[model samples]
Target: MSHAHPELRTPPALPEGGLRVIPLGGLGEIGRNMTVFEHAGKLLIVDCGVLFPEEHQPGVDVILPDFTSIRDRLDDVVAIVLTHGHEDHIGGVPYLLRERRDIPLVGSRLTLAFIDAKLKEHRIKPVAREVKEGDELSLGPFDCEFLAVNHSIPDALAVAIRTAAGLVLHTGDFKMDQFPLDKRITDLRGFARLGEEGVDLFLTDSTNAEVPGFTTSEGELTPAIDTVFRTAPKRVIVSSFASHVHRIQQVLDAAHLHGRKVAFVGRSMVRNMGIARDLGYLNVPKGLVVDMKVLEKLPADKIAVICTGSQGEPMAALSRMANRDHVIRIEEGDTVLLASSLIPGNENAIYRIINELTRWGANVVHKGNAKVHVSGHASAGELVYCYNIVKPRNVMPVHGEWRHLRSNGDLAVRTGVDPSRVILAEDGVVVDLVGGRAKITGKVPAGNVYVDGQTVGGATEGTLKDRRTLAEEGVITVVAIVDADTGQLAETPDFLARGFVSEEATFDAVVPLIEKALARAAEEGVGSAIQLEQLIARAVGSWANRTYRRSPMIIPVVIDA
Candidate 1:
């Protein structure tokens, strides 16, 4: 496919010999990993991704990066380079494609396939250029070299962008696994060669910088998974991230070896596996895989299920099964293995599900209980190794929380990189690399845009606050009909309370207090609907706080008769 976009022929307005590196997201945070490389007014975007919502962001579907910086500069964008196919790295492509469709997407074959599958769901046919390891592409003044890297998923890449100023290396999410499942180890030699050529700045993944030693390889988990398959008394159900094709491949291998038929149990699990298998990234034995319905008829000891919800997502398959609400039930002698890392904030929900599975007479195993999981990011030692190999003049830690970034920076200093050369930045901070030096230049618009239901960037903080208030304190709505001019009460006020009062007796008791307050407000000669609403709201709010020791959201609706 042609990777060139001849339509973007406008000459860029170059900065004074400096290349601007703007982190739109994925700095001092876990996900939504996007960065903008601007040189001579030409922009190249790296990894348009999204962040999953937290508990506090009630009703939000997903959180996307604020793209205000590039909204007006869509014409200047040359191409978008994807480091991997993980949702956190490519989830925001649909949103970006909506803004501009002509921008060429550059990534590995499988990465482009994953992106194509994702965009198909949005009914978008994107212009993608598939590039493998060692491929070079030049967009405007920026020349990029795609280098192979070992990550949880296949076809992960680290990008080295050569600008007029210097070469900037961005090590996407990677770990130094000497014996990777695919035998495609991270290209250390490539990094070393780039270092010898003199790299100006290095952006590295810091997700596991707090970890001390090297991260274990995907190959290491095979034996442990084999033991699970060999020892499990009945059905083996494994939970993992759907994007982890290597883990899924291991699971399939184990199942096939044990003569167990495999069945995928989650939406994303089935979809991603199908895509991977079709694209030859995942190997599946014929007739070894069966449909979900066929799984029900198979003997318990002869079936293995790979599913999502390793983090205990409420709507996920494993969570539903744990709650006894799924079509497939967890029975006695069944084993459920969580072959994934526990995300930091999801411990409570994950443990709750584990406890529920145990209560249902099923054996549950996880990273806390077994050696079935390993992190995909490099640790402190591996970060030290990369820093030594690249030997960049400046190091910027990306793709981590604050503590991880700080720890990664500290490791770089310990690796003989000068402390002055370590540049610490958060999202939206502009780091300019020029004259063989890197420094924070300025800031830009950076924050999360919440996706709620069908709306993107529609859920504001105020909307979330209202949802939280309604969830915690309930709502009390009072409807009153009054005279148009005089604001005199035409009838008695009607009160409706939801979640605040469960019993009719409690509601009846509160009605008299609300009535007395309304009567007093009418007697006080309220003149306007707004004035009466404020009066009744204050009265009802005070009564609820004093009498019930509660503060429900009091809403007053006045109608003119």
Candidate 2:
């Protein structure tokens, strides 16, 4: 199998009748899924999404797929095709639409509804075209067919794109759940039909490719969740992704069966579940769901709460509850059910919340402890089955980390796919399908565009480095008054430190080093305040590193006396 090379250069012009695939994100990571397809000088985008910030990305809200390569070609974009409504698959829609407000969005009915509601909050009305399974739409030069696929969320789809170059099938996040709560299993029949018709290239979900066997069915979690609601002595708090309609449906059924009222917490959970109910995606037992205020009035044993932050996001509802900062406190004997799989890069944060909730006397139940959650992507066995059914001429693994991608490629090869035809790509790596062959041709500018508060792409690596320094080593400020005639110290340097040294006397040893550096600068006839400040900063930084084995941020102020 061929893998992407880090030394790739800018791709040459697309071959005649060729389809160019450029993945801006979701290649080597778990979220921020997006891909740009160019054929006949028009672009068809698939899955504009966002990546949640990790612990190292301080103060960042979300990360978007860098649109630098396609910024100048927004006019060529025919539509943004979303396969599902999961945040990683659709959260970046509003941001992308902000660039071109008139860009049409095509997806299933529930998927469009979810995105439309989100867009309303951004004050942007979308031009949406809703499609269902067995629906086909002609977008520019690409003829697209949407097929039903079962996932954690309702109305998931896998799209097959037909162009002059060949047919490319993109299986957006999906799993073959034989006993899904909604009875919507992934369409292996459709895959077989496409295989009979000849799939030139297949872009499959690789999120669970590293896992050995088939994923556990969602139905298995019903009994587990019901048990939690039945046995809990107090309020049962179930946390999950806001878009996980099926899981919430099971929660509602369990609550109804156990004679308890359910209340949705978190703005997103309320909005999304409300949409799901109105759209008939989520079955709400009448009188079983109540307002948070109404549920609070009842005895704790009769109430069940559903909220977000299954991943332990610091500002999310569950995290706040764990920190005792939310209205719904984790009291003694309360049962907390984390009803989602742990996302990559979130192990530490999730464990911290689990520990905190346990400390607060809540019995924390998670995937590691019980059959409370399952992945939304197909495992290796299912992937191999699909590979045999589809039997595409070329295979490309999308939406996973490097290990998952490599493992997926290996699975395809083991299923008789040509080793050379398996394309292993990361974000920014360009692949072209020409003459029914897909290969990495070059690279593009696919970097993380961080969203900090109201600003997008404003946070840089340097900013994050400084934030880490401040959080880890702290900052020290040095103020020295210098004479006007000579850049000599007029007063002993005063040191103020934060997150570095607590006591003032702790920095006493560095004062003499600063004085000596100032004297050397004076003898060298350095009269500029900027130069003096630089000298003092360098001297103090060296002393701190040498004496305390700490390299904190140093701010030197030299005042002309």
After superposition, which runs of candidate 2 have C-alpha atoms over 4 Å from their true positions?
A: 523-525
Check candidate 2 and list the clashing pairs. Answer: none
TM agreement with the true structure for every prediction: 0.92, 0.98
Poorest stretch of ten by lDDT in candidate 1: 1-10
Candidate 1 Cα misplacement greater than 4 A, ranges: 1-14, 481-492, 501-526, 542-549
Please write out the lDDT profile of model 1 over residues 1-561, one tens digit for every residue: 001122323223335878998888898789999999998879999999988877777898778889997799999999999999998999999999988888999999888988898899888899989999999999899999999999999999999999888999999999999999899999999999999999999999999999999998788888999999999999999999999999999999999999999999888888899999998989999998999899889889999999889888889999999999898799999999999998767788899999999998988988987889999999888999888888889988999988898998898888888888898888887778879888776677778898887898888999998888788888998898876755566776777888796554555555566556656766786567788788778878887888788888999998888
Which of the numbered candidates is closest to the native, going by highest TM-score?
Answer: 2
Residue-by-residue lDDT tens digits, candidate 2, 189-257: 999999999999999999999999999999999889989998999999999999999899989898999
lDDT of 2 at 59: 91
Worst 10 residues of 2 by lDDT: 501-510
| CA lDDT scores, all candidates in order | 0.87, 0.93
